[model samples]
Target chain A: MHIVVCIKQVPDSAQIRVHPVTNTIMRQGVPAIVNPYDLYSLEEALRLKDRYGGRVTVLSMGPPQAETALRKAISFGADEAILVTDRAFAGSDTLATSYALASAIRQIEKDIPVDLVFAGKQTIDGDTAQVGPGIAKRLDMRLLTYISKIRELDALHGTITVERRAEGGVQVLKTKLPCLVTVLEGTNEMRFATMNNMFRAARYPLKVWNKESAGIEDLTKIGLKGSPTIVSKVFAPSPKAVKAEIIDTESNQPKDLVVTLLAKLFTKKPDLAHDIAKNAP
Target chain B: MSETTEPRKPARKKVELDPKLARYKGVWVFVEHERGQVHPVSWELMGEGRKLADKLGVELAGVVMGAPGEDTRTFCHQAMHHGADLCYLIADEVLRDYRNEPFTKGMTDLVNTWQPEILLIGATTLGRDLAGSVATTLKTGLTADCTELAIDMENRSLAATRPTFGGSLLCTIVTLNYRPQMATVRPRVMAMPKRDESRTGRIVEHPLGMIETAIITKVLEYIPDNLQGKPQLAFADIIVSGGRGMKKQENFQRIWDLAKVLGAEVGATRPIVQAGWVEADRQVGQSGKTVRPKLYIAAGISGAIQHRVGMEDSDVIIAINSDPNAPIFDFATYGIVGNAMVIVPALTDAFRQHLSTSRMAG
Candidate 1:
């Protein structure tokens, strides 16, 4: 089984802060990490390789710096890593990004037949969850998204069954091989890197491909020109004019504070108290 | 240096749609249903679609796909009650359950045949899965988890506004050249519309051409989630949520205590859930449940945009955090700048007493 997992490098969103006055992203010192969600997909692919005795290839598309993310994937035991980067790929949205990645996957297939493609459910930055399906459509591959567990994988029969999260229940779905899957988060724990794998990751010669090498022939469909959605404006969320009314007490005792708060709350909205009383079991 | 003085025009060119796409009309909402019941978000989108349709001077329609039954037709009438001017219905045995291949083909086929200008779907698991594949098959654009949807009358396009950069900033996106511009909005983000029983609409039937044998993916079984102890945060009248500041898993109990006193549901931020402080289902944020409780008390939550977008629409917000500068203070209706450990218990006791007294008085 040859599995290709797509990962992305994104700024650590938890530590990201917005400028107070400017309302712009304050990204100066924020570190970049492989999109957290992608780690689940990478780990799942590694697990599949572990069980099937096959190779796992990690793929990513971004600036040259994205090679770091691919290397990080190698540290988790991926057999190969490919970074598709080019100046023409700048300003691509989900549509164009999938086009470039799909083209690169087609190129990768020429070297080794890929049985499965794995991707994070969505990126923390873009959060569109569109590229995986977009690529599946372009490749004419079966797309299985929000997968929770791999119940069965009959490589010999070219069939797979898995639990897919749906609106109200989990749908146990069976599909053919050579499918593209977007794995949901919390499905598995990512394995820690071993010393031997760390050394191998550091020494691995990463493969870098640009638009032409990636087999992208249409210049209009590989970048901003190919992106159908245009971001017209980016602005800060307008602050609510009414600041929260701070509840204070001179006594500074929890009990006293509670008493005062309850008194004030009931005085202001008697209906709330009545509703709570009525609904109480 | 001698340079041609025509100020370098903005490098980006204004997008012009192919003349073929100009005929697409009407705003359509995908009426999502499960187990014979329609999701309320479908109605919310219907109400929102009504506004967009009115602005563009076009009809608002609902698209319902389900098994052949009266239940499917009833959903069409409900969609009209919520504001749909018409509905497109597709019924087939293959669509009895939510399988991506069949639903995507049905939806894409409907779009190709009926050519709606805009398509709205709830950002649920089923809707997201279907929307992505449908948009890809049509070679169009889709914006997910939109906070606002409006018609750009000047361009006759849908401007989908959503939080970007992890909800720190808001960006308005336009599918300038794509017909059937698509977007998904989280459930509870929009207000539920008044159901008008007097309203009526037309139902145009479509057929699902594919059969069960053609779809490679087959549903073997469906195990419903155990709802015994599940929290209904989306429709809760009151909610109390905790975050990383809760310090430990044990500390989350205080949030539950407060919620129990008020007959409310308990919610947590994503990090807290990821840390194993709480179950994943209790999480409330962009990646979790979007809630619109009547009163939401956020305890120890710093109010990141991801969490805010999920619960900011609550009728009233009360924030309790030790840090005075927590972002929750910006939008909360009331701020209690104190340790949640100290304040949550107090609020719980207070509510207990207050509720008992009210019961006695009544």
Candidate 2:
């Protein structure tokens, strides 16, 4: 079984800061890590490989620097890493990105038939959660998303069953192989890299593919040309008209603050006090 | 690679869309329903879609696909009451429960036959799963989790505004030349339109062309979430949420203590949820639940734009953080700069006593 996990290199969103004066993203110091959500998928893939005795290939699409992310995946026991990077791939939206990645996966399938594909539920940067399904549709694969648990994998019968999180219930779904699964976050803890695996990752030669190498035949279906969505405007959200009213007291004691806060809140919005009381246990 | 030019920077250039795409004429909202209950996000999208439709001088329509039953028909009427000028109803057994195969086929076929200039869907799990597949099958552009949707009059396209880079910045996206300019808006992002019981509209019936035999995937079982007593943060009127500054898991109990006293739901920031201090369902943020409660008391939250977007619409925001410079104070209605550990308990006690005293007086 060849399980290909799609990962992304994104700026550590938690650490990203916006320049106060300019209101522009301060990307200079932001470190790029493998999209945190993708780690769960990668870990799940690694576990599957350990059990099934097959190869776990990690795939990513980004700039050249994305190689570091794939190497990190390698250190965590991914058998192979492929980076699909190209200048033409810049400004690719979810649709264009999925098209390019699907083409690359098809290319990978030429060497080894892929039985299953894994992807993060969503990327932190885009937060779209569309690319996984887009890839599944492009590849004509069964798309299983928000999977909480992979209950069974029947290689002999060529099927898999998993628990998928829906709105208010968990749906136990059984589907054919050659399917794509996007695992929910916190599905499993990512394993720490071993020293020997770290050495292997450091020395491992990575496969770097541009558009042509990734088997992207249609030029229009890549990068800016292929992207139908255009950013008409980018701006910062306007701050609220009023700043918060700081509740101050003589002693600056917690009790004093609470008393002032409650008094002020009730005096101004009496309805709120009534509402709270109505809901009180 | 060179930096990509901003699409707006080329303001002087004229964009000629494909003539074939120009024929798409109406606005469609996919009304998602499950077990006879329609998701509220569907109504929210319908409300947004009405404005877009009126702006575009087109009819607003809802697309409802499910089993051929009273429930499907009931959803159509609800859609009309919620501002849809018409609803495209596709009823079939295969679509009773959402199976990607038949539903995607039904949606894409409807789009192909009766081309809509714009399509809106709720950004729920079911809608996202369907929209992505349908958009791909049709090769159309789809923007997800849009906070704002409007019509750009120049070329008459859908402008989808959403938080980017984890909510630090907002970007307006437009599907310049794609027919059925598709977008998904999360629940609570848009105001719920007041329903008109007397409102009426047209219902166009469509058929699901596929059968269950053709579908590869099967739903083995559905274990309903035992939500008898779970956090319903999305609809909670009063929410008391904790953040990273809560220190640790033990400290989270204080948040619950306050919530219990006030009958407020307990919420957590994404970090706290990720750290296993709270369930993911209790998380309130850009990636979690978007809540617009009457009062939101945030303790120890630094108010990153992510967590801010989810709760910013609350009628009143009370931020409690030790750091005076915490961003939460910037927009909160009331700011208390003190250790959340102390302030949370004090607030709980104060509210408990205050409410009891008020009850006696009344």
Number of the top lDDT candidate: 2
User: What DockQ number belongs to candidate 2?
Assistant: 0.63
First chain TM-score in every candidate? 0.96, 0.96
Model 2: CA > 4 A from native: A249-253, B1-8, B11-14
TM-score of chain A of 1: 0.96
Worst lDDT run of 10 residues, candidate 1 chain B, spans: B1-10
Which pairs of residues clash in candidate 1, taking residues 3 or more apart in a chain or in different chains?
Answer: none
Instruction: List ranges where model 1 is wrong by over 4 Å.
Output: A250-252, B1-17
Query: With candidate 2 superimposed using the best TM-score fit, by how many Å does residue B139's alpha carbon deviate from the native?
Result: 1.2
- Expressed as tens digits, the lDDT of each residue in A138-239 for candidate 2 is 999999999999999999899999999888789999999999999988799999999999999999999999889999999998888788777877788888
Q: Candidate 2 residues B1-362, lDDT tens each?
A: 00122445553246677999989999999999887799999998889889999998899999999998899989999999999989999989888777777888999999999999998888888888998898889888888889888877888878788888888888888887788899999999898999998999989998777878899999999898998888898888999999988998998899999999999999999889888888888999887899999999999999999999999999899999999988888899999999999999999999999999999999
| Backbone clashes under 3 angstroms, per model | 0, 0
Worst 10 residues of 1 chain A by lDDT: A272-281
